[model samples]
Target: MKALEPIDRTQRAQVVALTGKYIEQASRIFLRHFVMLPVFFDLSGRLAGMYKVHGRTRCIRYNPWLFARYYEENLAVTVPHEVSHYLTDTIHGRRGIRPHGKEWREIMALFGADDQVIADFDLSGIPGRSYQTEDYRCACRSHRLTHIRHNRIRRGWRYYCKSCNTELRR
Candidate 1:
């Protein structure tokens, strides 16, 4: 991995702007009561973004790493994807509905995104993050795990290889 790069505030500004645009689109059309929500970015790796509500205030927490890695796609798709979640959640308001239910799909369709998106959100070419990874080995293969996974393993957590059914060696 190369040196960790500084946070790109320009990209962050772009996300903020695009988020506002999505919120506007949702408000102007289907969701009559839709309103703008706050957005924050973290270095999360598991998900692109998530919509959360605190009492009457709704917000979005997203991964800056994703937006930095896939700049255009994140602007066009990822931002709008979370916007769908925000809109659907506002419409339902914690009635225990599924995140990607039929209503959410309809909103996504309004943004011209079907189940298939044209942009390449794939991370195959993205190099391992600037953070270090620890080496581990199973009977079948060697693995390099990120710090989060290594920490989990250190806490008495064991991972077994599916093919060999053998515990990984740290």
Candidate 2:
């Protein structure tokens, strides 16, 4: 395993402090409606934010850099949007419903947030492939190669078209 560079302790402390402030503010806003509200700031997941079902927990899964990258105006709205998910969960009993639904949207509006929370990160289309795969059909003309075996084949083994005599990449 590769050794990692040490993190700046002061910067880590600052990030923790800022996250604590957000969690505290969110807790206060939701406490009136909820019997208990637990807010957590997670750094590991790709999810920007999620409300855990039945737990009444609102989680903001964003890197510490987001605090500096996004404006306070946007954070103010996003923080509440995630909180509203918790509120909706509490009200509706966390049943079969879309993650973001009509009930959640109304709650977000009532919380004095924007019509939509501007994300600090991308929630765009799915990630694209870096390289063409042998699993996929070859792009070369005259000879189209179809993958045969599911198992890995040995290198230097011929993958040529017997009909066209075109060599295919392994």
Candidate 3:
């Protein structure tokens, strides 16, 4: 790996824990000669699938629930796909340019991860339960709503809108 700064021991341990669990599941289908590196998994709005940051960490922003739903059956390949990035980065040092170039893709294939399958997934498209409400509209006006549960509403008082008298959609 490039001479990048090391991550905190605790953070590295957490990554190992998650990586080990994924590896245990993946080893049955792929090679098991790799180790997890410490990296930050920044869950932001601008991510496309998983990526490596600072040459040490793998960052993926998929929703835990949605990811489990999609990859629960083949979790190992997905994990290896991400690890392949780490491996490729280390081998090439800082000279690595293309994110999913030929070398990285080859590494993924070696680890039994299908590049096509990983490419088919639009990681950003996975639906996550919104803790923030989507925009709502009534008449000519539109506004955002709270994400409170339906059970939290107190009877008939819930239907009336604070902006206008428009009865809101549930």
Candidate 4:
């Protein structure tokens, strides 16, 4: 199969416009004006979209590669998914509700979108980064910890094996 091209400028514009449209709808539905969060197409890997908050900053990120392959589905589902996250956070404080709890589902229903949490898409040709893994052992089995996890362990964090209920160690 030929490698699929990333989303073009026109598609990017459509995504931004759709995001704005959803924000407008959510404001009307909730009877409060919701700020327009920034939209970015810098995500990769299997995930389709993400709603992220860093301190006072908030933004929605999309995988351009996934959008190129599943344009319509991403437009219909991914847009609403991220928008719902934004609205949920805006209405209910972030720490007060679960990420996919009832409040989020209610918002999704109000938006007339499926409440399914994750996008299931084949990522055969998507460009992804490879992480170095470290080997660790538990009582029952060996495990491969990604570089991120290994660094956390180095910084006094601990991980456990589910089956053996033992701490993972180098």
Candidate 5:
């Protein structure tokens, strides 16, 4: 597998332009002014793109490594996937509907893009994050939990062992 490299300026510009085009198409289809959301290439790992809302701020984030690895597919599928999320949020407010539910599917159909939720790609050369894990014990065996799950356990969430059917403990 080839080592991962950052996408160059021209490729980045093409992604931005394509995002704009999709946003325009959605705006026209919905007959509503969809604000051009900011696009960022700061994401990593297996996710290709995400439509994120933090408080009142919102932006579309793309994994540069994945984009560089799968340029054409990212341009065709990933762009529309994230844009459809943005459009669905704009129209339905993201409360009552699921992420890839009917509203999102409708917008995807309007965009004429595949409605598949995730891209299937070999991630051998792509850079990904490694989470630190903590060991826990059940009756039958020990389990390793990532930091996210460890924190949740500390916050009063309990995880059970499937074979032993007992709560995992530190």
Candidate 6:
């Protein structure tokens, strides 16, 4: 994670061109429904890019914030990642295959990607999802754990009390 870079004409052009090239290459490999797809950019915080197949028009909506931060580093993989997703979606005839299933993985490998299952970006500044907690009673005392921890106990991982060394029960 580096600071966000200022994406300019060169960066924008490169992203568009690279996406077009990958689309062409994928078309050559497999018969796709559409040959040409539009690339769009925005200042998105969560998503790096998205392969939107609306009716007949296939498009890539990317985050300019990422473009400003990592410039080409983000696009080099992100663009192809979205394209692979498009391939995965198209190959399955739209919406049934897993997002990062075997087909998508194969496509990534073909495009020189390392088969990365998820994005590798900085999310330290992003707010974490909070959870509610419940109190569980042990032989010695009561302890508070998140709902997930409580569920783990219910599912069969008997939590222990550190001080008393006893199993906490709900």
For all candidates in order, the CA lDDT equals 0.74, 0.50, 0.51, 0.93, 0.92, 0.78
Q: Choose the strongest candidate by lDDT.
A: 4
Q: List candidate 1 segments past 4 Å from native.
A: 1-7, 31-33, 116-170
Top candidate, metric TM-score: 5
lDDT of 5: 0.92
Encode model 4's per-residue lDDT on 1-170: one tens digit a residue.
78788999999999999999999998787788999989999998888999999999999999999999999999999999999999888889899699999999998899899999877889999977788999999999999999999999999999999998999999
For lDDT, candidate 1 versus 2, the one ahead is 1
Write model 1 residue lDDT over 21-129, tens digit each, in one string.
8788877886475666777886465466677777777788877766666677666677888888888777776587777778788889898865433345555433344
What C-alpha lDDT does candidate 6 achieve relative to the native structure? 0.78
Query: lDDT by residue for model 3 over 2-59, one digit each (tens)?
Result: 3223234554455446556544544544455545444343333322236456444545
Return the TM-score for candidate 4, rounded to 2 decimals: 0.81
Give me the displacement of residue 100 in model 5, in angstroms.
1.5
Q: Show the lowest summed lDDT stretch of 10 residues, model 3.
A: 40-49
Candidate 4 vs candidate 6: the TM-score winner is: 4
Candidate 2 residue lDDT tens string, 9-97: 56445444554554455557657434434444443223444556534344444333343333353356555666667567766756786
Candidate 4 clashing pairs?
Answer: none
C-alpha lDDT of candidate 1 relative to the true structure? 0.74
- How many clashes (backbone N, Cα, C below 3 Å) per candidate? 0, 0, 1, 0, 0, 4
State how far residue 75 of model 4 sits from its true place (Å).
Answer: 0.8
Pick out the ten consecutive residues of candidate 5 with the lowest summed lDDT.
Answer: 1-10
lDDT per residue as tens, model 6, 77-128 = 7888988888777777656677888889899888897667567778544323
Candidate number that wins on TM-score, 1 or 4: 4
In model 1, the worst 10-residue window by lDDT is 116-125
TM-scores for all candidates? 0.63, 0.47, 0.43, 0.81, 0.84, 0.64
